[model samples]
Target: MNITRRALLAGTAALPLVASAQTASGVGRRTMNHVKDHITRLVDQHRDGVAPIVSLGDPVLRQPADPFDGQVDDKLLAEFIELMQRTMRAAPGVGLAAPQIGVPVRIAVLEDPATVSDEVAEARHRYPLEFFAAINPDYRPNGHKRRGFYEGCLSMPGYTGVVNRPYSVHATYTDPTGHPHHKTFTGWQARIVQHETDHLRGTVYVDKLEPRSLSTTENYLDNWNDPIPTRAAQALRFHLD
Candidate 1:
């Protein structure tokens, strides 16, 4: 799922200001530096035109997004969606939300082509999702069955945490062209949808994680990628139903 970050208006000037706010919000110096470098890279990559993805601790991410009003052929909305797609691809993430790029609009994009090994795919019950965008999305758990899996976000670069979510979800939303859509997603696709939907409602994966299970990407790859530790669920007090 694409994680949303930052609260400032878009542009170079807004970055430093957001960085300072992140610092004041008690994010460590190391984390702040990491975020700055991250923001710089995003800006450099999208220098052509894409908007930058915000980093965590920006108050904007905590605010609920505005609903898309179905403005078909809206030039600015079209540009925003294009830039978000480009940004998600550059981040190499499976999904992204407008809140991730400093716009608090209820719009998101997600896609996955079963890019991992069969082992990993089976572990997560993964499947392919053709590219799609949702506006003003609303969703709910489809069943009591839940699955826990490692989750990451483009906005929260270099971290992965385990979050348990329902194995299936039902959702309804409008497409950019004002067409409405409703579907039930299972497995990894459900996870992706829930993650993006969380952003629209002003939440992130961290909020649902067993906090101690959260780790940097490097550390997770080095130490935790194998069989999940037995006490992880107990420690996080998470119940896998």
Candidate 2:
């Protein structure tokens, strides 16, 4: 999530794993410095202690996370759920994976208020998301439709690229309470699910994007009306369906 696969593909595959959840790799340092500052500001304003995001290039982000067995007490899972939810909200991102916080467990949390103008809401099919947690989740595309848009990551703070994804998906998982659950998702909801699930599988959005379309947030905003690059489809020789 933090470091795009292309960065590694470009010759930095040797990035090390984070020693601790709070530690970021050399690549993460620059972006995380800003994240830390943002956290500090949040602390100063609201006193929330948010967990730091694990940077890209960490081995954990590249390795499949461990699935949780119901062996642990409900108390612990409840606490972990709260912590992950708080961390996700604190990071202020729509989703957070266990590996992003250096926990190698197959758990993730997601919520989105779609706090934007009508254009964004219409474009993303955004909806107000209530707090939800997924344990050992999995999903499959409907194969009926596909979507692409500028995707960003908390781990990969400053950069964004357009990623094509299924417009709808069906997924299944267990809740922290050991309850089994299954559901279908579409639009932005589906995208969020895919993004977090990818983290659990050691796959990042960067792995699916056009390498030439990658750009810093600032650059992306400056160069394109939307995050999608103008010549990206032609240059990349791919069409969004």
Candidate 3:
């Protein structure tokens, strides 16, 4: 869902999307140059070099991000990844995608210390994930299993909704060093991977969320803070499966 102007002005919107680096023939030099220039201008605006996270209404967030086809040199790409990681941590979010930073590229960084109460952790199947970048990442559901939980976005700020996602997924992505990797992620980590990958495709959690389950952050904390979303599902009259 789109954030209201009031929320955007309040600077409450959440984190950004990711992409891969590989040589490709279709990407024009001119386009890459423009992207480089755009990134430079964005980074220049902040003293700490952290690009401001783009909000929901931004066109960049709605458009599909380009694949990281040598858009910038290795040094610049590294700096951008580091900037994204810093932005995610500053946003205090578990993940961030490139589109959130106004860069329409298939790139994202994710990490979660999973510092929560035991009950919450167990209910959500939450666990710590080491920081890693996913470029041009894609995933496929491993089975029919799915799980629903409260989800929020940095771009959509101030709201949370119940989203059912595949319980596990087999994912493929290229790392910053241009090496390809494949792995299966389960539980909360699978959810994080799918969420970021969807950004590269111009999708957001709201698109897949239970609309009736939507709640302002305050309401969510006050009324529906259960480890599982059973109470919310019952009260909201929404099916979770």
Residue-level error in angstroms, candidate 2, position 237: 7.1
What lDDT score belongs to each candidate, Candidate 1 first? 0.69, 0.69, 0.79
Error of 2 at 109 (Å): 0.2
| Steric collisions counted per model | 0, 3, 16
Give stretches of model 1 more than 4 Å off: 2-49, 70-73, 227-241
- In TM-score terms, candidate 3 sits at 0.87
**lDDT of candidate model 3 versus the reference:** 0.79
What is the C-alpha lDDT profile of model 2 across 68-159, one tens digit per residue? 54424576566666666777665567888978877666888988876766876787787776879998999999777887876788777678
TM-score of each: 0.76, 0.76, 0.87
Model 3: per-residue Cα lDDT over 62-99, one tens digit each: 88887777777888788788888878877767888899
How does candidate 1 fare on TM-score? 0.76
Report lDDT (Cα) of residue 82, candidate 3.
Answer: 85
Root-mean-square deviation (CA) per prediction: 11.0, 10.4, 5.4
Model 3 CA deviation exceeding 4 Å by range? 1-27, 47-49
Clashing pairs in 2: 2-155, 2-156, 3-56
User: Top TM-score: which candidate number?
Assistant: 3
